[model samples]
Target: MKSKYNFQVQHEDGSVFDMYQMGIWVESFHIYSPNPDRTFLEFPGKHGSYLSASYMKNRKIKISFQVETGSEYELDQLKHSIYNIFYTDQEFIITRDLSPGNILYALQNEEYDFDNITGEDADFNLTLTMADPFVYGQERIGTLADDAGYIDYNGTAETKPAFSFDVLAPITHLDIVSDDGYMRIGDPYTVEETPFEPETIILNDNMNTLTGWGPASSVDGGTVAGQMSVLNSNDFIASDYGSGSAWHGPSVKKSLSQQLQDFKVECYFRQAAYVNPKDTGRVELYLLDINNNVIAKLAMADAWKNMPKNRAEVRLGDTSNNNYMVNTSGKTDTWWNDFQGVIRLERIGTKFFAYVANITRDSASKHFRTWFTGFDDLEGKFQGKVAQVQLHLGCYGTDSAPSQAFQRIKVSKLNQPVTNQVPYIALPGDKIDINFKKSEILINGEERKDLKDFGASFFSFKKGRNNLFILPEGRVSTTVTWREAFK
Candidate 1:
């Protein structure tokens, strides 16, 4: 609320003089200088003030107003004050305020530091969780047909030994609900046998909307467990070998614990058995924030809709697809080929920088660890809004009936940040005084202060440790980050 004026008078000769002046009744000051460029005013601290510069051609003098306090109304009043001052004196026909912008021009053109400041700089840092706990997919059982009286007994007792009737609903049509409202539906499942004869499953194709398997349930889909059970339209099969289809496809329901922040979503998949390379089933890795909003999705060439506006897809290792980096390794077109795709999402502020990488079989094979994807602009543009996270085993577009099967998923948080050490130059014998007001000084094993009641003095240590002492006051006190002074 207080205003003061400073005048730095520079005569024609290379000399300077300082003058202090107070604002007059109208809350304005008028300066008459023969040389407009040579005479200017300076302000203390950084005030939201402006200057308007004008030169009087008639009187060969320059007139400018020094504004100390300015708001919308104050600025208007100052403008009128300058205009009145100019019109009242015919000799000073031209009048204006030396605004900050105008003053900057003068400083740059005349090479003058009106503020006597040194460096002009601005800086900012991008903050994000470098490492999040490695989150893995949690497993639960699907629905079963073990309930009593649910089946229609069609066989009559007259037919020798009565046969048990299995007129129960198909597991494919199974719908399991958790106490927490997590729902999982079983869909027609696909089974692929590898050369090793291991049965690999393709999970979700219909309910691609979900992020994770919602909650855990028993294998029979009876009650809620620590995890969630998948629901489906088909009935659960106990044993089926020939058809290559063992389980019903489940409508994927997202589990809440699967939610995460900055993290890596990965999946391992192989081609379907007895299927051609072009017919190979695809798996997907997806990311969704707490709001159940889809952040991003990645899959093999044939498994996704071509979002020309946002994505590019190609056959694995096909250089012709150019979008696939040269480093991507795998048969350009092959089925049952095991490969791992990883999407590393680094949440920076309201935006995310993602790096997608596809790794092949050979560990020694060279490939680019990542490729650039367009940034995800957050809806609210608020940093750290992301909470829940999930990994997708299957994301639509699978030539096979169901989706691809996933092996394992995991998540982990990084370690704490270490205190950065700052080096300082010091002499063997010097009095180090810290502003903390603690009277303490010891240099080369010698006490610099007579009494140890030093609350604000610096600690004088031997030349080796190079450590700066700091005493924290309270919770609100900022952690000290400084180096000791040296000779």
Candidate 2:
């Protein structure tokens, strides 16, 4: 840490400019303690006015800087850089050594003046007008199961937070009630169905919670495969394991695989992190032989180290051609784009089929696709090892690999239909991001303005513990995220 006078300027793009780095120093800062607006009632011929109510107003700030340069060229270039850095028509952040956790949301909207001498030194002043009366801290995250939830909030002032729902079942409407009233989605919705009938699921894992084979699981660290998957606002993390929070689910054992003939391994998942095509680690939906060798796999990774191109493909026997999007060459650009749901590879009788479903124009449809035809082909060569197989969702040996999240996976020959308990605002595999601060709602990464009820409005959380309930909630989960406020 530097002295109290040192200042740091952070841009929106994560670029930072330090006063000490560029031979610049904070000359001084002129700030008046924040004041409050007051209302008063004056009685006839009264000596003093009666105080009614008071409200804090936005704070104004002014800071001066002195710049010293080594050469005339350096001085000229430095002046232009300073002007461009602070004079942009955007909001930047200012932090001081004196204030460790507080961030000054400074905008160069107000009047400012810049002056410098060509010899070696310069001076300038910056003025800012803050809209919010209180300072804000870092964001805090919490999760709620149904309506009964109790979480500690460490904040002084009232804060408006954003929320996201990882809906577990079908519901007609979602109503979260509080002392004032309730927040609800009143618009009508449609529930889409799978293209085929699913029956006798061999394995099913609802990524809503972290439970693989329940207690006494095994993988890299004696856990489930690709178990390090991440999802937003998810309560089940890498650590939320053990017999206490473990859920009873089905798994594909070695004996079951021996009798299995027509097997369909379906993965309902979403890419938790998609910065670009070339990510840090890859994600895979794979099946292993008795010896833990890769029999077949659906991988999302960069093709090669030399040629770091992003791709999503199905592998038969782990060859170079099979690794770099052979049949899945062009079919996976959409999944790499925004794959809506279900990446599946199954063996019906003797022939193998691969299919993927994606959302195009606000609609999700599974396109029945296959690259392997017979045993003579590259993919069909692995048909002999299909029966003696075990299920694993993530990459082999790479415990903390890809940033993809599996929502619900069902391993069944013929798909089946399961109706919702009741009509709901959202259902299983339906992930929604709702922001009260911005008045925005994104359903499955897309904006949904039509779902807003006639009187649906935004609300905030008060300081300390809040007692609230989500109505019509049987098997639904919601995660709340908020930054604290301070006076």
Candidate 3:
């Protein structure tokens, strides 16, 4: 009995053709072995081989077919069409009916030979070299399921047996914003540290526990050793006292008129001793507005049984009262005695957000706590004006003035958002419209100097995926067309 087979050929231009439908009879098809050649390395003295490897060489397939026509014209036309397909060097894919999904990628390896050529019929023999040795399936089969979902055998199909879903729209136009501008679309702020140096010092040590304020005072303040200005309140009497000792460092004021809109106050301080368990004696650091009104305050107790060691509690308020306590159980703490504390206050739009970190001694810790306090009337009043920031220490309740020494006090303006620039990707055949000029475009990571306008085709998507990035100046609009290619 003779076997029957159907052949399908796909050309390099993505056109499919059927040989049987073209009046060509497929006589016999020959497929060579698929296994790769193995190579082994052996030593003269050793009985076993040292190394062995397999290499995949090109595979070959041959086909013998017959063509019949009634006239010379029909025979010439059929022969010419078949020659146009098999005579070229371009690659093609071949599939047989017996092998439903298995397809081979191959190219013409030998010259076509036509035997028994007559005015009516002819026999042709051709050979193909496989570009890839293995015969691949029509579609790829992945073992792992995707995050979106996978085809479940238990689920019922609506129309077809395949699963399908829609993807998000691609990014088309991107805008690039400059960081130099006062107000950008995204966050343009960069954190900078400014060392603290007090211009003035005020000390009221009524109890005479400390001499006075300044470097000569019996307090440790500066980075080096010596008596730095100390805020000592010895006003404690035999009975009780209202406010014990009070110390205020020289105010570091910045004009609200400055281009910088946000500011942070960082101070490195060490408590003289732990707070007395009996009485509520606490150390307070104040951030004052232009009118000397306390906007934010950091209150620290020597130690709390429920709280972490060396942690300070933060409160947000205006001139009226220091109400909003952001973090009740303040997570900021320091293992070492000498440590830095930071308070960041940023004016974003109409509202204000504050971030405070008490213990900054450990390098591996992320102790900074944040709060989002609604719009401040004081900030609105002093908008684009001068604001005063002062560091103060006071002793509350019956506790004596705990020696609170501050050093490396700094006031710096903080940038708005964490980052000003972002990245975007572009796929193949995508039309990317950049709202910003070419100077602001960054393709992959390198800046494209030749880009002049948004119309430039600076990127082309590869067979799979392509990445494109841009820095927007203001509001940005983008669209993308995602095209997938398969071999």
Candidate 4:
């Protein structure tokens, strides 16, 4: 008696067919045992032979069925349908109750045999070779969320499978889809195993909030009132002082108990109006230690006696009154009044570098007038820690309110990890090909070199979710696609 069984064939293009609907009855299906490829080593002195570990090779499957047709045309159609399954170079997913899971297989050796046709009816046998020896679940285990920032995966089988996802933003979260699973990743706020934390935009205020910063000294600290001091009609931090007073402007500090080794602090400022040569003072930005000692000072002096009229200088200062300028050059008075520039301070090891750039009116242009200054050995005086940052507007010759507007102040750490998420994993023995397009690809926080020469890279999923991140440089979109293999 022919054993009765139900089975379905799913094409590579996602079309499925039930054998019964096509007047095809499955007589029986047989799956051969997995064949393991093994090796042996013989030693001259050893009495017994050594057997190497064995690995299961591809398995073979056979399906026996009969096709019934009422007419010659119908018989031709049924034969063509059966030929469609074996003729094309595509894999088909075959599900059978005898197999523990769905089998991924394709035509084996292009071999098919049929008995003599009797009245448009025929019995046939088909051979198939499993692409992967191990059966896999019909359902995939991972999902890319709508936002593409969150990826979740649930363990479907006891075995581990490789997984991958794309990153469109600086921060992302990869979590195990299990209810009790506790894997959270790609957090920008928390720094893990790295010397420097992620770059933080501590203060990006557009005159909206003024909290946590220290009080302004010579003037009201927060947003200043009046149109004359506005830049592009935006409210800014202003310093107003009466005669006889030297220091003006506001200062903000972050207390650090030796947590930071290297950092970069930057801000933008411009003189609200023109100043007389004699009455013009200096605009200073400096960092101080715990004891209120200046470690570094970036100052622009408006002295008439200077060779170029206005000189912007970077100086290194210590606690013992030792102060010397690292670099100084003349800047035009026109550049001073419209001084929309950025002051950046970078501290690395024992060396400090200062950069000042005069931004052009058209912000789209990268060309800018800039100056750089650097020095070493300043950390010895300040105990190797910067505890305070002060932005000051002062007058040297005369004590008068200097209309200086400050905006776009920011502080960030240097050399921090670009992406802190771990790579998703692939199961052992699974081969996956990942393709990236229109993206600046980074793997494990480093630029992937293989992608530089080629458009795609192949990965062998090593029994886990593979950690992959894609960041689109411009208007381009990022996408990732792959197929999983099983044994």
Candidate 5:
């Protein structure tokens, strides 16, 4: 539209003209506010006038005035009508005065109809019966026995390695030990057939218990991280390593695959020095897939740093299958001690993130970074299947692989997450669209109709002012525009 327009001055507001004189031929009408009193109509004049407008404060329901028609009589009547229409609301209440472009100016105030609107005023509240993203009624997944595991973290040669697989409550702390000397804390070590104490591995809520099994009189200092639980006696693995100085563990599978689509996984680990960053010895957090051999391993050491936690890595699938790795390489300091790392895997897309932390009193060192690997890069590997997950104390090596202890190990599945959106203002005649797939939009005290296909057919604005609800669609909403009466 052209910036300039023509206009003709009609009778002033003080005149006695009973006719609806043309106050200003608005080339374009921009409703600053939908509420009649708080609204400011901006548009170019049909009679050679610029589209500039301004608001007049210090009045009861302050109105924005513009130069047009020069007819005070018509302007006063028009202004009065607009003010009356909004101030005496039939649907909405002009509870707050709004700036010209404030996005919320379009929504009706909560106090619109004192009789219709009950309950405390609230932000957006969505309810879904089919596939709600917010709240669900007691929908539990996975058996109790399928959610917990154990590992050994006690360092020593006199203790036996022990672990559990309870369903009542998932075990979050474990320690496996054995009679051995000199455990590598870094990578590149050969797997050895050593005497491991299968009975010494204990899963407990406290980490100090494992200190007693410390390597032949060494000062044992470690923390048992995460929540704790023990299901039943039959719910554990005795010695899955199976002969020849090996270790074995029963596995637990994640229940909600589709629902846990876009979520995160976190855990903590403390491996023995031999299994550290030197010999590539490390702990196995979880075994996601077994069909195509897609497992996630936490490497103790890589081509990076020399600390067990320094060379921390997340390798998906097996080395033979594309070796998809997300490394937190070279980020080690005092903060790496007793810290947590998170891996956020996106459900829809083949992508994930990793976060690391270093312990510091009541907090942690804020330094953290992540690396991403695409599906195409892992084509020969696997798509996105996470089946079996085991918290192997000493992951890479065999049962004869000297025992490694873990102070704490907890796993939690992220639930429906919330994201914020940019706000925009709606004006009179503006059309809007809202989507409510696994949710419903609640405006005031009622549910809004779904507008997925027909673009906003379920919404209409009153002549003065009104407010409505829009539900979360997991996507951006459609664009809305204002309509002029004459246009």
Candidate 6:
């Protein structure tokens, strides 16, 4: 505001004010850290208390200063300016020269609590409260070129960035996917969904006995149940000197209690114990219809074709077992030979979405990557069609005799299907704004969010480097802007 004063505020109408310029002298500026919003609750017979949730309350800022009053005319004019800036019901963006990297969004809290000293100098103690907890930096913007599909973001903390661009062609959906997040703008059939009270059944459970499973071995590898189920090589041989058609594999089947409407199946496994990635093992989750024919296939191939570094390959919704999903990584890092991850296959209404996440006891749900079944009438193909799913892993190299360590086989079912729709379309020549901070979508400066799509997640960029893949490269010029935030 006026040549970088000590304290300043920006109003919603773009007007700015500096503290010293308005004859205001600061005595002491106190900023208090907010108390945490969680409550400590004791269990029925437990010794220690536990916190319910983890978050902080709103922050409080107190600005104590004095305003000068000289002549009668000067006194009236100065007090009027103070009344105009403070004592407002609106929230203001406040800044300070001390915290140059941070800004505050606050509203006037409580009363002005001022005193008139001899009608010459007026002392004022103003309190402001902030709903947002973090201190923010100035907004920095960048552009993604025509051929680029990735953005490497570096920030002190995670931020909700805004995307803006003019569309060169008409597009129904602008789907952006990252390792930790997913956002689809202008998706016609699928909206934001949250499964309430999901019922998850552990099918082909290895912790118990592998009862429903059978081996239709093309090669010599067999299955064994232990701490982790092992789909090991049958005997010692070289890597793939035999026929590929009659491959080594194990398949398990389970019947659904009722006809399926929506489903989610996950296979948690380690590719091998001592070594895994180099064995070139493939774990295919087959969703079969009532007649035991395959309807959908989500496969995770570790080190395809026995290459060392070519790990983290995933295939989705393929009938022929080929055609890897573009830009899908099953494992978080490719170089690790002992990779432990979870493969998830889900159906929302007619659309099928596949997601993979690297999991560990310390860091659960790490690096989530997703791929959609971008095909036509996938709903009609498997509405009431899916009866049981088969978990199969096969075609392993006999040298390592790698037994794929199968962990948990969890099949969670939603109480109801997700049919909510949020259609956010950006036409040719239209300027698009996807505001994750405000959780708002504005096309050409107009808000178009409706009740059907309420509480939709706009998705955000996490801390450190966020690698994002925004597809169909050359059609749209992109600009992303966000402020660096301190915790």
C-alpha RMSD by candidate, in order = 33.7, 14.1, 30.2, 22.9, 28.4, 25.0
lDDT tens digits by residue: candidate 5, 250-307: 2222322232333345444443343444422334454455352444554433222344
List candidate 2 segments past 4 Å from native.
Answer: 1-3, 7-24, 29-31, 43-50, 70-92, 150-156, 170-173, 186-430, 444-446, 471-476
User: How do the predictions measure up, each by TM-score?
Assistant: 0.26, 0.47, 0.34, 0.40, 0.29, 0.46
Candidate 6 local lDDT, 439-467, one digit each (tens) = 76656544545421332467667776666
The alpha-carbon deviation from the true structure for residue 254 of candidate 4, after best TM-score superposition, in angstroms, is 6.3
Estimate candidate 3's alpha-carbon lDDT, on a 0 to 1 scale: 0.44
- Which run of 10 residues does model 6 get worst, by summed lDDT? 234-243
Between candidates 3 and 4, the lDDT winner: 4
Tell me the tens digit of each residue's lDDT in model 2 across 1-487: 3335777788744568887777778877655456689999999999999999977787767888887778878888887787777765556777776665666666666655547554777788887666555667876788776466755556766666777777777656676666544577743344552222234656655655444333213322123432343355342223222221122111232323343445677655544324443333334555655555555666444333222233556666544324322345344443343333555676654456665543333332212222332222445556534433333333222222234445565666443336632233455787777688657776765456577776766777776777667766674677888878776
> Candidate 4's residue-wise lDDT over 1-487, tens digit each?
2235657687744567767766788887777877778888889999988997776777787888987788877887888787876665656777664543554555555567568478688898887786556555544444434423332333332333333434333332233222222222332233553223234443344433434445433221222122223346444444343334333333444444343457777766665334443345455566666776666666665545322244566656643555454345435544544466666777777777777776644412221456667767644643345666665555433434345556655655544444553322212221222222213233422223333323222323334444434332221133333333444
Counting only residues 3 or more apart in sequence or on different chains, how many pairs clash (N, Cα, C under 3 Å) in candidate 5? 71
| Model 1 segments more than 4 A misplaced | 1-261, 267-280, 301-338, 362-370, 373-403, 412-487
What ranking emerges by lDDT with the best candidate at the front? 6, 2, 4, 3, 5, 1
The CA lDDT of each predicted structure is: 0.27, 0.55, 0.44, 0.51, 0.29, 0.58
Best first by TM-score, ranked: 2, 6, 4, 3, 5, 1
Worst 10 residues of 3 by lDDT: 155-164
Candidate 4 vs candidate 6, lDDT winner: 6
* Per-residue accuracy of model 1 over 1-487 as CA lDDT, tens digit each: 3223333333211123222222321224333232222334557786654455633221112212233433445544544443332232111111122321111001101111112112221111111110111111111111122321111112111000101112122122112121112112112233431112111112323322224455211111112112212234221111211121221222223433433444433333332322233332333333345554444444443332322111212211112321221123232332213334443444433444444444444422212233555444445432332233333222222333222344343332212222332111122222222122122232222223442232222322222322121111110111221222111
The stretch of ten residues in a row with the least summed lDDT in candidate 2 is 241-250
Instruction: Write the residue-wise lDDT of candidate 3 on 1-487 in tens digits.
Output: 2237668888743567788788888998887876477888998998988558866678788888988889878888888898777755667878787876767777887777567577778998888897666555444322212221222221111111111111123222233212221111212222352222111122212332323222211111211111213233432111212232332222122223333345544444555343433232234455555555555655554444323244455555543554454444343343312334444444444455555554334332223232234446454543442254433443333344444544434455544323332222332322332212112333322223343333333232233222233333222233322212222
Candidate 3 segments exceeding 4 Å error: 1-3, 138-423, 427-487
